[model samples]
Target: MVLVAVLVVVVVVVLFAVVDLGPPHATTNKAAIPNRLR
Candidate 1:
């Protein structure tokens, strides 16, 4: 139970970090997708 809680907290922290770091990469991917389709 304790281990599960720790894992959950770690996952949440990683997710927040990803979101904080993700916008630029996400935008680049979004822009690239249209070019790829074209």
Candidate 2:
């Protein structure tokens, strides 16, 4: 159970890192989403 908890934490950290360093396409889509909603 402890190992599973550690793994989940590590995965969350990696996901955060990837999102922080995300590619331009991902950022563009995020921006475009708001405009599309309007």
Candidate 3:
């Protein structure tokens, strides 16, 4: 149970990180605008 909770937390954190890394919002810096389009 403890291990599962830890795993879930890790997955959620990773997903949040990935979402931030993946989105190309217009508010991001101009330099990031280039590559963030991917």
Candidate 4:
């Protein structure tokens, strides 16, 4: 059915979004924000 197809697509998109593409504890450089951004 059309409804079933749409549901499958939605579920696939949600699963893809939840997939992690990197290590959980990875760190990155932090940059200081300008005064205007605070």
Please provide TM-scores, in order, for all candidate models, with all chains considered together. 0.55, 0.56, 0.55, 0.51
Give candidate 2 regions above 4 Å deviation.
23-38
lDDT for each candidate structure: 0.72, 0.72, 0.71, 0.50
Global fold similarity of model 3 (TM-score): 0.55
| Clash total of candidate 4 | 0
RMSD of candidate 4 to the truth, in angstroms, is 9.2
List model 3 lDDT by residue over 1-38, tens digit each.
99999999999987865675666555664556468667
Where is model 4 poorest over a 10-residue stretch in terms of lDDT?
27-36
Give lDDT tens digits, candidate 2, residues 1-38.
99999999999987865665555476576676566568
Worst 10 residues of 1 by lDDT: 17-26
User: Whole-model lDDT, candidate 2?
Assistant: 0.72
Cα lDDT of model 4 by residue, 1-38, tens digit: 99999999999975653453222332321222232235
Which RMSD values do the candidates have, in order? 7.3, 6.5, 7.2, 9.2
Question: Can you give the lDDT of residue 4 in candidate 4?
Answer: 100
Model 2 vs truth, CA RMSD: 6.5
Over 1-38, each residue of candidate 1 has an lDDT whose tens digit, in order, gives 99999999999987865665555485576676566568
